[model samples]
Target: MINTILVTDDNVLDNAIIRNYLYKERYNIVSALNGREALELLESRNIDLILLDMVMPVMDGYEFMKVFSKTPFYKEIPIIVTSSLDGVENIEKILEYDVFDYIIKPLDHINRLILVNKIKTAVKHRNLISDLNKATKIIDTLSTTKNI
Candidate 1:
């Protein structure tokens, strides 16, 4: 299960609600008022999952994702895009980003739980894969040294 979360949104009420819910659920929560703030915090913190907002005053989600993609570390962090815009056009807009999940605004509690669980499962799988990769690399190095 993911212990930490990064929530990025410009709406104070939205942020508070999400924070309160996650807090009640006993999950660690970190928040950013806008994409720019989120990015700065992201640079310093290794969070388990991201809940991103699409529209903001400075540095929207799409732009943030574009810049985030350039950083190798950000690639592995799963992002769940949250936006008030649920129309086909908006969904289509963010589809290219390959976000782990999408949540429409007025964030439903059950839907939020679903997203949380999905992130937990994904994070667990990621850890397993990372461990396996490390083991494989070690084995390969040992085999090569033995043959030398």
Candidate 2:
């Protein structure tokens, strides 16, 4: 199945590059200019992962994560932070939001490969969690029916 990825970055060029790379991998790309727009997209899109940029005009990554984490349904979606901020403090701050991975940009070929690998890993983990949830629900229903 093609997973939908939400790329949230203020830089149009960054978004274009990421979309171009992921397109080759057959993943559906959804671009957002800022965290607010990303939140709006999340309301309608079935996003499997988020590629977030820390600095943006409106509602930066930190603010986005604060709002997003409060959302129970969305909290499970894996987020990979892509930012130019390489400071350890910056990374630690973002990590507090529980992102799946943090990647520093400009995405060179090696960084792109890392991004793709991380995406693949996150998608697999999400799928496994989904399958487990389904199994647990089925078991619960069977147990309920047996009791009845």
Winning candidate number (lDDT): 2
Q: For each candidate, C-alpha RMSD in Å?
A: 2.4, 0.9
TM-score of each: 0.83, 0.96
Clashes of each: 0, 0
Which model scores highest in TM-score?
Answer: 2
Root mean square deviation (Cα) for candidate 2: 0.9
Off by over 4 Å in 2: none
In order, candidate lDDTs are 0.82, 0.93
- Tens-digit lDDT string for candidate 1 (29-132): 89999889999988888777788889988899988989888888777678888788899989998988888878787768787777667656766655676678
Instruction: Give a tens-digit lDDT track for model 2, residues 1-148.
Output: 8889999999999899999999998999999999999999999999999999999997999999999999999967999999999998998999999999999999999999999899889988888887888999999999999999
